[model samples]
Target: MKLVIGGAYQGKRAYAEGHDSIQKWANGETCPEEEIFSCEGMVDFHLYLRRLLQEGKEQYVREQLIPKLLQENPGIVLVTNELGYGIVPIDPFDRSWRELTGRICTELAEHADEVTRVVCGIPVVLK
Candidate 1:
């Protein structure tokens, strides 16, 4: 798998699209959960984690989702925002979402074949 990360509006999706010729793409904010495993690429993956948390599926995401994705679609590319930056959130759920996104992205990066961070539309490879 390949992982792309950056701050909001950093053009991570465009960078991933330009770098890979993936025909099918899913938006994590709206796509069905099962679609992620089969899509060629996905964007706003941090939002998906937020959704899972809001739906009370945090434990499943923490325990099974990543492993399932790796086993089922190891070639998929994921584009997520780096959510741990900036001031901490006052809302507990927001803080949990940010933390979960960070931890999950870290795990994904560790296993990803390539990892890229986009800054002002410039892609920087970190793995």
Candidate 2:
């Protein structure tokens, strides 16, 4: 598996696209929740995580969904925003989301075959 992270609109999707021929691309903000599992990989996974949190499904995501996806698709690539670099959010939920996202990213990075951080459309490999 591969993980790509960067700030919002930093061309993370473009970079991922350049690296692989993604057949399943789902937008976290708009894709139907049921359809998310059918996707081979995820772009803007932070947004999807937020959606899960909003729906009180975070536990399911952390315990079931992510593991299931990774097990089913070992080559899946996840693209997410690097949420820790900006000013901390004022809302408690936002703060929790940021923290959880960081933990998730850290875990993914540890297991990923490749980890990349994109800045200004340039990718820097970290693992």
lDDT of 1 by residue, 1-127 (tens): 9999999999899999999999999999999989999999999999888888989999999999999999999999999999888899999999999989999999999999999999999999999
Compared with the true structure, model 2 gives a TM-score of 0.90
lDDT of 1 at 13: 92
Clashes of each: 0, 0
Over 55-114, each residue of candidate 2 has an lDDT whose tens digit, in order, gives: 998788677776776677677788999999999999999998999899888888888899
Full-model lDDT for every candidate = 0.94, 0.86
Stretches > 4 Å off in candidate 1: none
Error of 2 at 7 (Å): 1.0
User: TM-scores of all models?
Assistant: 0.98, 0.90
What pairs collide in candidate 2?
none
